[model samples]
Target: MKGSFSISVQNNTVKYAFSLKRNITIIQGDSATGKTTLVDLIREYEQNGTDSGISLSCEKKCRVLEGNDWNSHLSLLKNCIIFIDEGNRFVESKEFASEVKKSDNYFVIVTREGLENLPYSIEEIYGIHTSGKYSDLKQVYHEFYKIYGNFNLENKIQKLITEDSNSGFDFFNSVSQKKYICESAGCKSNIYKKLLESGSENVLAIVDGAAFGSQMNLVSELLEKRKNLSLFVPESFEWIILKSGVVKDVEKILEHPEDFADSTEFFSWEQFFTKLLTEKTKGTYLKYSKQKLNPNYLSDSIKNKILNLDLLAFLQNSVQ
Candidate 1:
């Protein structure tokens, strides 16, 4: 019933595997590396009668919970298998982890990163990587289409990369930014809607700031609507900060003394942004596509950006 699925990339091939027991399974990987695909596959197998029912009677029984709603679903853990798309979203809550420990049911958590500190009894954890081969890329794309029903622009952009080897780097850069737009249009739209209705004048939008591209679009929308909004961006987002055209409105607000409280600490955005851009360009060729980049390098670059951002400090000061 409950299981975990992963596909390991080695020597240009992907080796897929799944668990056989009704135990907690954790699938960890970076963004766009198919963590969600594995979860959907397991959910489908369980629904189609191919997998043993670990928690629910039918495969159609899986549910998604956000915020406090996760607590209500914890009760069903004994008879239902819960698949969390972004497991890290819940890791900050001790009460949630406590409830998870008290539950006897199975859960399969899929996250961009692993959480070793959580209290749940995880039976197994697996890491998946993106495939390097064009054939594998096609297969993954097809699988993605099957699950999501239709291919979006991000899929089309990736497909373009697969078709033209010479355009890899350019396509990657363009698509990476476009992919952010795709996600912001869909995923972050919910958060935007929530903010619009919450009636809060001072709103804090916390995100994986260095995520770049579409993620920034989400922040842009939030900042445009909420005059008193503050963004908790990763340090790497300094690239956008330095890029004069990207966030002009926000920069203007920060510069004008009359626009914000005197307590607001405004700094030289252009200087910090330029420094990050220079450093990143010196380290890696801009022609490098994420698909072609070394996984360790990619992970480290992202993690360092997050760690150096002092995100909590920004959140504390921004959130009312």
Candidate 2:
């Protein structure tokens, strides 16, 4: 039910590469940026045409969906990688974004319009920048982070008032708050017990994509009782956005003299930014935390799909 596709295009003047995600991922840019050309190269490769500029590798067959055929195609499709050109008109509507996330397939969508439901910013799109690799599975761990795993469920769940099912969650709740899985911890009687006790409201459980490799079966057992109990994105969208958005600002701010001259205690860029993030957001910061608690399940080549997944936009749009 899972696979990967990677294509790199290189010519005398340009070189670009990006991979697709398990759910929806977008690529939007001005014309002649090689958006359609990239698709054409994939098609040519599919047709067995020789294009020295395009190199592709895949675990399974890849198909590009046409606008007229999307709905019917999805109905018939089950597990596969699909490329939907925006010209096929799939990314233009809120409805299409809704339906696509609920499917069990991977997608690479090209369009200029932003789908608020998807976790892509204009900067993170495929063709936006020509140089970087799409998925980097480097493990980011910190000595300060105490490992958390199989422990007292009862103790983790008892600490607070029940949260309403319809209560919405954004990046803020994750920063410095504990919603209490159990104050004393819930017994392993059922993972969903706290969720059920809390009520039918939208309780979002977000984990790292790497967890899929190590403990997905355990996670799945919990889900069998209730599908809405948890969530897992490639990493955190907070990390993704920081890397994509604020880092630029940090670099720009660095251009002027004495931004950090006053602070002798902050030596590393990571330390400076961690301090800055805490200051800016009132300690609603993401730093020094490890990427995931579990071991990886996928090979180095295909893991990027999970690493780069935008679970934030996907869940916000998919959950009711």
Candidate 3:
């Protein structure tokens, strides 16, 4: 269940080949992008098998979950890759998020709207596009592409905006050292509003990419019109700590997060990393807490180690 799964589903007119590495994968894009068609193929195959004029090949079962009875349907499934097309109000509900956290199955949801209740990764958000590889040019080929890319931090930052007021903000606020203004957006949803009101020429938003999928589209659209803003999205603050080599025996986990991140136990990678940090630093001077960061972590030796990471190298230039 921790391993990745690749799926190949096709009919005479179209084909989709993609891999799902995490528990939650979101498929969204413009119209006629084969998002719905991908779900239809799975539903069709589920109801009629090979005779449905479709072929599906995957190690795990692929099925569509919808309707008001989705809760009941989900209860009976395990170790599956469930697909949910848009218009299902259940997807946006807390009940669905609750079930998803408890279920061992993976999910591939198609929606343009973000689900704030679900802590899906920004890296998992994808858009479908035709790969343009087809036989006789009649059969279309669709593939999944990442909707968002890593932030470019080449520009100097005049202000820093973090998604939360907790440990993450504390760390960044300490590091800023009045070199630039560091403020919290309170939550991911408020990041857009913070950007709207900011008067800085260059702004950097540091958010937990692990659970920021819901606010990405809005922030992305805002970025297009506002060249002054850029994003510094790590999976989470805990991920930054783990990636900093501050924690021992985390190199493997950091390298292959998918292998250790259990879907049912932790809703997002952020939770997984948080638990890892708390456990690894238990009873140590660097003991971890989401509510308040340990003062020891802010010491020069430890602080420099974290800032030295490639992801946070921009802080050095900004502070200078």
Q: Write the per-residue lDDT of candidate 2 for residues 1-320, one digit (tens) a residue.
A: 33234545444444555554334445655786567766665666656644554556566556677766568767776666667766666566666656564666666777765444443322224444434333221121211022123222223332221121111122323221444331211222233355456554434443323112223334445545653354333332323334334333554543431234222232212334334534544433222222321122123332333234343333223311
Q: Compose the digit string of candidate 3's lDDT tens values, residues 1-320.
A: 57688898999988888888788888877787788888999999999999999999999999899998999999999999999999998999998999998889999999989898998887788777576632111111111012122334565568999997999999999999898889999998899999888774788788888888888778878877776777767888999899898899999888988889889888888899999999999999999999998999999999999999886788988887
Model 1 clash pairs are 1-52, 1-54, 47-59, 55-79, 55-80, 77-105, 180-214, 181-214
Q: For candidate 1, lDDT tens digit of each residue in 1-320?
A: 22222322122223343332323445554676776654554455445543432222333245444455767656654545567777547754667656555554455576544343342112234455445431122211112111112222122221111111222222223334443211221222244454444443333333222122223334345555655444433322333222323223345433431223111121222223334344444545332222343333234454334333343232112212
What ranges in model 3 sit over 4 Å off? 133-155
Q: Candidate 2 local accuracy as lDDT?
A: 0.41
Question: What is the alpha-carbon lDDT of model 3 when measured against the actual structure?
Answer: 0.84
lDDT of candidates 1 onward, in order = 0.37, 0.41, 0.84
Report the poorest 10 consecutive residues by lDDT, candidate 1.
139-148
Per-prediction backbone clash count:
8, 21, 0
TM-scores of the candidates in the order shown: 0.29, 0.38, 0.91
Q: What is candidate 1's CA lDDT for residue 135?
A: 14
| Model 3 CA RMSD to the hidden true structure, in angstroms | 4.1
